[model samples]
Target: SSPPSYQNGLWGHVGKTKTPEDVDALVGPRPGLKGEGHLFDRLSKNRDAVVVLDEIEKAHPAMINEFLLGVLGNGQMQNKKTGETIDIGKSIFILTSNCFQTMITHRYRQEKDDVAALESLHSSLANTIRTWVHSGVSASGKGE
Candidate 1:
């Protein structure tokens, strides 16, 4: 078969258009960076899908809070190109991080189900946050 075609803004057309080639092409030239571009772009485009950024402890602490706020605020983001604001109103955003605790607890409280497994999950989550916060270490322990 022919090679992938990551031309224009075509990477965002996954599942709705052509085959895997289209999806592969979407992962542009810079295989490392551009490959993830489609994922971010699609997450931003979807109106209802809730994209969860797991293992967020890996991100810088300063940015982690802001990132959580943005995701929770319905994909609220700033466009560097146009210096404008954008929102994924239809999407529900959730970010899991290793630092923050209160927000996660608040979110957990909002959930309808109180199953044992769910409670255990929240407890584990809170314990993780406590560990990170008390240790005064960034997720990477890079020491700011």
Candidate 2:
């Protein structure tokens, strides 16, 4: 299925989130500033916004566990610096990755039916993501 269209939102690339401060820059308040981060700033202004995090697989495990888990699970995130909160209950989050593109492409090519191939890919990807989330490690066996 295709991703939903959003009239408002913010986009971020995880390649830039190599440190805790980077995560804060995306989701929390900027250091030494009263204003919110890019994502939170947009979210605060537009409650129905969508947030797209590209290359999510590249984010550090601490970011996934400490920051994303809170935002995703609670639909809200707090700025540690400013002691402010951003409610994301009405927002949508889209996480994109190319972690297993080669394997997915190979599997798709091996399948005869397109529907079946997509279904299989979906299931496999879901299972892999579940494993990664539970284990706090990625396919490359590197994370926390």
lDDT, each prediction = 0.44, 0.72
Error of 2 at 105 (Å): 0.7
Model 2 poorest 10 in a row by lDDT: 1-10
Candidate 1, overall lDDT? 0.44
lDDT of 2 by residue, 1-144 (tens): 122335786778865578767776676645585544666666778878877888877886656887777788998877667778877798888888887888877887888488977897899889988787666566553532
> Model 1: per-residue lDDT, tens digit, 1-144?
222223222122222313333333332223332233344355455545555444444543433333334445465654322334456566554445444466556767766476775677779867876666455446453322
Q: Can you give the TM-score per candidate against the true fold?
A: 0.38, 0.79
Task: Give the lDDT of residue 97 in candidate 1.
Answer: 45
Best by lDDT: 2
Off by over 4 Å in 2: 1-7, 29-36, 114-118, 138-144
Looking at candidate 1, the ten consecutive residues that score lowest on lDDT are 8-17
lDDT of 2 at 45: 81
Candidate 1 ranges beyond 4 A from true positions: 1-40, 73-75, 94-124, 127-144
